[model samples]
Target: MYYTLHQLQIFLKISELQSITRASEELHLTQPAVSIQLKNFQDQFPIPLTEVVGRQLFITDFGKEIARAAEKIINQVEEINYKTMAYQGNLSGRLKISVVSTGKYVMPYFMADFMTENKGVDLIMDVTNKSKVVRSLELNEVDFALVSVLPEKLKVDTVELMPNKLFYVSNYDRKFPKAVSKKYLFEKIPLIYREPGSATRNAMESFIEKNNYSVHKKIELTSNEAVKQAVISGLGCSIMPLIGNKNALKNNELKIIPVRGLPITTTWNLIWLKSKNLSPVAVAFLNYLKDRKEGIIQKKFSWIEDFINV
Candidate 1:
């Protein structure tokens, strides 16, 4: 019953990716090498870690428990290494961040700049839904979670980063008036909505309920990109975040309709569990964000006036 931390890491990567090939690609190892390592790691435990069904891999409940423990071990080792490195006055460590889907457009810029400045820092970023991001924060799985709507139940420390604005968008060919009334929006236009549980969908629903209005959902899509494509294809209009649709709007693939009371504005926030121990890298990144907050605002959202005033 012997397994190296490296093997545990390989197993965790495979579990995360759910594919040997993908894990191999991410780890820079060949498929066969990854498979051998996974097998060796699994042999150390009596219970099956993973199961293959119809060419797809899935981690069992036991495997999930093992992964949880493995993550803690990995974090502990990383913390020890970084603490030692800190004594040497080196800024070399890993920063794990989980960001909501919409943050994909802006977070890379932050990561790129941070990584460029601290060449020894490794960044592990997960772009996921708000629910998953919240879950990660609750589990202390990441150093920080970036999201628009902070969960009310979680005991978290949050810093507002920027604004997240949802605009009513449609194909440019629709030719709707720039400023239509809310009544006209609900009655005259069919809506293409995101699937249930999405932050955008939930926010829009809450807004509708608060305003005592009902909008028809003619189409439902899982992702923002899908909703944008549906609008581009003339399926129906959707309330979308302007963060990810910059290119689309710029190219006239989708136009922001000037609906009255449009652009439901929300604030982007960086949240982390207050109970979790903050690593040096996490502290550094938080400080970096604070120091560069103004620059981030100007760089990421300088064009907001164009949309807000449209």
Candidate 2:
């Protein structure tokens, strides 16, 4: 059997998108060209790679197995290219990181300088919830994971980055006393909550449980942005990370309520499993963070200290 790397690439893209048209669009090729290549690729194997049902394309089980192998091959090829660049005295490789949703606001600032200095490095950052982020780290799918809360069961080493403060905030239009009691806020006002497995949700729950307060559950949202929008729309107040609320708070779209024991504080950390070997790109990034994290926090996030004080 004979197959080219281009064929493997096309098959992988087709499997990922499950639509020839979409794969073509993403690959920057015409639909006819993509279909022709896909047909040629499939001809090299006896088993069917894909099936169409009611005009919707779906990769078959066999296709999925092939796609997985194709991905490994492509990654290896990319690594070979990166190695060549490294030999030429250029830093080049893929850097994959999985971060909790709120970390999206903070991690980019830390990465901006490193990414600028390393032009040949390809950064693949996934912004997701805590459970998925942890899972990615556990499976060694990503070089590192950014989170406010450390996973209890995973034995990992962490580099502390900065403070993550959670605040109880409501729509600016909502009227409240200068200092509302925690009991009143929890018992009377409806509280929007992040979904289970979110670090923010875990923090909020711990605070409420500690204070022996019972909250009125309004609705559950999946992301920090969604929860912020809900609060801004006056749907309900929510306990949110200050990082995700800076813009809304600055614009007076949301207002933080003053209460004792407010602004739950946690440290943002970059974590990796102790057992995994660090790639050159990952080690460079870790070194960058170790050397410059304090400066980045001072420059980009000094405003957070001022906001919390007020």
Top-lDDT candidate index: 2
What does the lDDT read for residue 80 in candidate 2? 95
Number of clashing pairs, model 1? 0
Off by over 4 Å in 1: 1-8, 28-84, 177-181
Per-residue lDDT of model 2, residues 269-310, tens digit only: 999999989988999999999899899999999878757874
lDDT at residue 219 of model 2 (Cα atoms): 84
TM-score of 1: 0.81
Worst 10 residues of 2 by lDDT: 301-310
Tens digit per residue, CA lDDT, model 1, 237-256? 87889888877888888898
Candidate 2 residue runs with Cα over 4 Å from true position: 1-7, 17-47, 177-179
CA lDDT scores, all candidates in order = 0.84, 0.91
Top candidate when judged by TM-score against the true structure: 2
